[model samples]
Target: MRNTETIPAELSTLAACQEELVSITQCAEAGISKHAVLRLVRAGAWVRITRGVYDTNPVPVRDRICADYHDHVRRRAAWIGLLAYPDGAATGGCALALLGVGGLPSELAPEVSRPTWMDAGVRPGTVLRRYGTFPVVQRHGRDVAELVHALAQGLLTLPRDHAVAAICDALREDRICLADLGRIRSLIRGRRGVVAVRAWLELVPGRDASPSETFTRLSLIDHGVPPDGQQIVFRLGGTFLGRVDFAWILPDGRYVVLEVDGREFHSGNGMLADDATRQNGLVGTDRVIVLRFPAPRDSADGDIGGQVAERLHPLGWVPGGSIGPVVHLD
Candidate 1:
């Protein structure tokens, strides 16, 4: 009874809508009868995600188990909030999702803010806030809070590791830079979590390419073994030795390379072989010791900080020197 592959001709108008979400009013306008919508819903062809909203995507069940599916769910929630309050703009995690920023928690609550409201009704899973004035920008054709504003909003609420990971994601994606850090601070000024967010900001070098790398770096810092640099490129004579996720220069001028392997970026046979070759090249350089930390299934998988510390201590890396800089992109 499921018809995910084809859209009925009677629902052409709904299919033409910009997003998967379509209102009942819009369906009526498109010449689709209420009976037809009801029948489709009964047939599992259309899903009702909200009171009067339908998700026309009809995605397969198997496809709903991956990270991409989770991201789609986040976007769907944002759309629901946006559709419910047309004048409201997506902010916080909703804006981050729409902007394609990663390193977000698995659970995302849709948030929207508007200057005013009429008959305030209940939005099932969305959070509504009132704001006098704020900067708004369009992302994915929907109104969203500006990048730094959204980051500030998200930072105020996300967990410590998640906040830092989001900042790292923003920097890695070139969505923000060290210069924007001040603006982000200004937005969160006088807020409850400003102190913690500021401390985390100082800890971020904005050079780690993945959330796993950020987490790995944070673990090291917590154990008083922060790396001197991140995303450091090395060269042996005229050949490139490849870039390391993190590196520390010992007193004797040797280097400790920390590589964080996240499944998202490092998968399949090709990536594995490339990683092996890169590791071989780095070791052949004869002045570096490489440490690889793979993605963990649970919090108890391994001690990233302890492992790195074990390698670093033997090389005369003291308890602390200085962490990497949050480089200005400009």
Candidate 2:
């Protein structure tokens, strides 16, 4: 029979308390009894967060304690295999925790609670009502369900997509601010059901009009290109021309627009024809200098920022001050 003495010691060191239970049972042939578990709990070596659930160490604060409680509730609910609920109960503060957005006040932490049936009578604590469907993904060889739960009771609201977009948009606006990105990245990097996390990161819209536009914008921002408004509109000869994705005005009555060429915006022959007509209109007024940037995804040698700066520097638009690289907030 495997020794049971080493099991509690192993569980104490785990990063996530939920994962430690598996090791506890696996270490003994007959499995550890409730009495033994209780002994560990009474000794203060473990914490009985809820019925049949144990946290090996003291939880830091109210939020963590609540999270542990919800985790316990969810595990209990899942073990009984109840119907009408998602496979996994979402823990409180999950929405903010998962997306990595900030702005939560400290006092609000106590309000978040776990989702459970009415009869569970678990303290309402700060559990937020469910908003959307949970997406399932595999992690660490197990099926885990992903869903949003309130942080700080209902003191702070975390909407799934909006929260994600907010973080992504914030990152794009100021690449140096990465605390939120770093925090969320660390939480989800190895967690279960993080496919949604990956998809959110890859598709979340940046400040640029398109993904290609972002590539150029990043290059320019990082390489000291002059700042330009994205999607800037102008009028020529009393006719309103459509907004250009990136625009910089020159002192010589000339305007430069960096058009990051990509299939999404220029895929069909009709789009190509429309683009040509627009270029001609701008050229006729002698008011525009369109610089086409090679799609970075397709061109290995292209440097969109470098190319834009090279063309515009002679025309009087110059880079100023140092800007930092994109930072993932976590």
lDDT of 2: 0.45
What does candidate 2's lDDT look like per residue over 91-120, in tens digits?
Answer: 333333322333222222212222333436
1-330 per-residue lDDT for model 1 (tens digits): 676344446556544333477767667777667777777788888877676667776675336665577677777777788876767899888888888888777667768988775455856777875545678888645689887888888888777777778878898888888888888878888877577677766866656778777778778877778878888777766577677788887887667888878878889999889889989988886777888989742222468888878878887887455434322111
Residue 147's C-alpha lDDT in candidate 1?
78
Give candidate 1's error at residue 288 in angstroms: 2.6
Residue 275 accuracy (lDDT) in model 2: 72
Per-prediction TM-score to the true structure, in the order listed: 0.80, 0.40
Best by TM-score: 1
In candidate 1 the C-alpha lDDT for residue 161 amounts to 74
Worst 10 residues of 2 by lDDT: 321-330
How much does each candidate deviate from the true structure in C-alpha RMSD? 4.9, 16.9
- The lDDT per prediction is 0.74, 0.45
